[model samples]
Target: MSDTAPTSVVDQVLAAVSELLPEIAASAAERDRTRSLPRYVLDLLSSAGAFSVTVPTTHGGPGGGAAVAFEVTRLLATADPNVAQIPQSHFVYLRLAELAGSASLLDELFGAVLTGERVANAQSERTGRTVTDQTTRMRLVDGATVVDGRKFYCTGSLTADWIAVLGRDEDDVEQVGFVRAGTSGLTIVDDWTGMGQRTTASGTITFEGVRVDPSHVVPRQRAVTGPHGYGAFAQGLHAAIDVGIARGALTEAAAFVRSSTRPWFEADVERAEQDPLLVQRFGELEVDVRAAESALVVAGAAVDAIASAPPSRVDDVAREASLQVAAAKVLGDRAALAVTSALFELGSTRSSDDGLNLHRHWRNARTHTLHDPVRWKLQHLGRWSVAGTPPPRGPQF
Candidate 1:
């Protein structure tokens, strides 16, 4: 697998990011403080068609696949992880439109993202703590779906133009749907102040008889899989964020060590780069980031192959993709946690800046990794390996 950015365009995209980093990083704490992505920067990225990567070529998009998305995410996240993640959900749903749904739906979905519209996920809940407890109920009323539930961790709800929501069917099966902005009964609680990923605006959204048209609902029979199953797009998104977070941590650590003027113990080391320990840790983190990127590329290839091949071949490809995606998530999450924790150790004493809010890397990794640990995913893979049985088919996440 050629590990370089696949095309000149991709290389161009990567290069353009450097000039934007200073401004992007400058806004990181403020976005976290405000609990939202800076509007103007998002507009810049959207106008550049960053969100168009996974859309099919016929749709007038980049058609760059997961590898491109992965690189773009890491590059952007090197400045602001929260901002990088904000658009990830858009890409995942775009993948859905490309492979399994209608072109009209694609236009309705990705079009909004391309036009600088934001999105959020109203999946996680507050009280009914089970992984599958989607207390946010929806019912059909007067040609519209009525929603009534509270969603915890509703990222970007305050600024979202649309939200991809999951709810239960009449027979208790699950269905994924969308709720447009300004829908009646949709309310956001301004209460997402947190320890990390604050720019995510991950507040709670409550739906009380919110009305959505039948067109907003993804068809029942069209359900392929939820976010956390074999070949699940959600795992790909998770892996992207994990890699981005780790890469961002390493970048911050490198900058901090190169310029910190503070003293350490009996010696005023002056420069963090001068420390042998820092060098060793940086080398280790570099290897980890490269490994995660490679794993993601392999997973992307596997997904594309499965998506392109016969149905009989799909299961095998999906299983391979799932294992690799889970492995990537686990490795990336661990790498981010390890890298950030080591930075703090290298810093010795916490300084005022402390290198771009280094603690947020650890916090973001913890929150994302804990969402559905890659270890549990590994256990599922193990069951498939040991029993000669494919992992269960259907959306569990």
Candidate 2:
């Protein structure tokens, strides 16, 4: 583990992130087979300062902003999409801290983030009619906030030091309750058995009368107020992760073909790499990967743009960021699905051997991309393109 200082130059930040990829990629297949990521990888990432890119400079961080942070996510995803995604909510809550978290709350959470302590999210419910529907409820009991509800798809809940639970209060407003892991009545079950992203631990969390500090709960109003860029940033990160999976799949496809795959008999070629059709297919996958990467670049810059815009211009930047992030989502989904599928197709039958576990990329891409529907993303872009209608402001958009 490299010890990275808090004040980050973009290059140094990227370098630190780069250093971890080889080790991560080397062990990725095995970890996926076992369905567990080592906890120390988080520590190594923290020690490397990968999680602090979004931390403001005033707080002894580099404040590398959205673009750099997405870049980090993309690189990590190429190694292990599960590990890459584990902290997605950690970053989300960092932005939430900016919204409704009190200054003291900010200090505590940001401090934990800068040190690489993980914060998991407990937001989506298993039985909700829609993504935003909440069955979990929070109410006041003896001047203390008491939470009771079950959350599913609670990604990273088991791995986190703290859990941020989204719930509806008596007033019917969505709010987040921050609870320490293992708090009484808080149970994080390792029940995630998704075909892909199997190690994400995206399972069920039950908050049965969990007591939460009032100050630890972020008010929904403040979190939703102002020129919101969290949606764009979050979506952009999702795009980055998908693109990384594509890149990883493409890379492994080429390597597996070169090392192990025999050319089709009709091709009359000694090497699969020399097969004209395989080469063409690889080229096509590369194009898709490039397009997705380019889209993320554009969208990430738009996310960065939102930080410095004046209040009058905030709406414009915010819309642009959302539109571009939506574009990234579309392109990313296409590339990840295409490239990961092509991996086995290009490498031939031996690639499917369970021992290689090459299928993990496609599995991860399929499972993780389900976090949001790409069709809705396309609809938003289509609506924006045809009528100049901005996407509705919400977590999904």
Query: What C-alpha lDDT, on a 0 to 100 scale, does residue 45 get in candidate 2?
Result: 86
In model 1, the number of clashes is: 1
Which candidate has the highest TM-score of all? 2
Q: Supply the TM-score for candidate 1.
A: 0.85
Tell me the tens digit of each residue's lDDT in model 2 across 187-299. 88888888998877576999999999888888765645556777877788888889999999899889999999999999999888999999999999899999999989999
Poorest stretch of ten by lDDT in candidate 2: 220-229
Error of 2 at 149 (Å): 0.9
Off by over 4 Å in 1: 1-19, 33-37, 98-103, 226-231, 261-272, 350-356, 384-389, 394-397
Q: How many backbone clashes does candidate 2 have?
A: 0
CA lDDT of every candidate: 0.67, 0.85
Ten contiguous residues with the weakest lDDT in model 1: 221-230
